[model samples]
Target: MAERYGVVPTRRQRLPLVLGVLVSLVLLAWLLWAAWSHSTPAVAGGLTSYDVVSSHQVRVVVDVSRQDGDPVTCTVSAQAEDHVVVGEDDVTFPAGPARTVQTTMTLRTEREATSVAVTDCRAGSGGPGARAPGR
Candidate 1:
């Protein structure tokens, strides 16, 4: 009788090994997804900024907050007719989930105000509060 040089894997042994590897991969992927989803925070509540144009004065309303923390110091800027009308303000708040800051400034230009723009609005770290980072 010829002796087998190497041992061959039986069908039962091969199936269990293949199935075990596939199941482990699937479980690892699910765990990674769950961790990522929980770390990120969603923009809860109504946080928005708008420029209100009127006859005498132009008003800028800035609303910003974190998901679970005190109100962040948001820097606000306003412009009229391509000129820097409002500079910037570092507004802080007490310990809470979120906060809103509203600032208003009067324009002293003789020319009729055509348009108003608000930019450089930021929170948490400090950035130009201009329409967020990547839209």
Candidate 2:
């Protein structure tokens, strides 16, 4: 009988195919690790206390005690009555297992404020504050 149009792959061909798949997997894993490392926070901390020091400025202090390398970049924002008042700011410091960072926010209005929300606070990972995954 005549041979089939497409023959099965021999052992030599299968060996190369397996090796190629393994190499691809290793490369993919490495890429994933690099991305994760880059995104992780270089410093660990959280907002501890915030107070209005004056009519036009407010003082904010954060406590960071979990990180081990590099100073954390802090970003602070303030909002009054659901409207954003102060924009973001960046603060850097030396690497510390535990440390406090303080920043002052200048307000646009001196009138008594009802409520304020401060957000976009983050360290490391680049930028003033840590951004969401898609942001």
Tens-digit lDDT string for candidate 1 (9-111):
7898799999999999999999999999766643222224444455434444445445556434444444456573534333333345544433333333334
lDDT, model 1, position 67 = 54
Question: What lDDT does model 2 reach?
Answer: 0.54
State each model's CA lDDT, in order. Answer: 0.46, 0.54
Q: Cα RMSD to native, each candidate?
A: 9.0, 7.8
TM agreement with the true structure for every prediction: 0.35, 0.49
Evaluate residue 50 in candidate 2 and report its C-alpha lDDT on the 0 to 100 scale. Answer: 65
**For model 2, where is the 10-residue window of minimal lDDT?**
126-135
Scored by lDDT, model 1 comes in at 0.46
TM-score result, candidate 2: 0.49
Per-candidate clashes come to: 4, 0
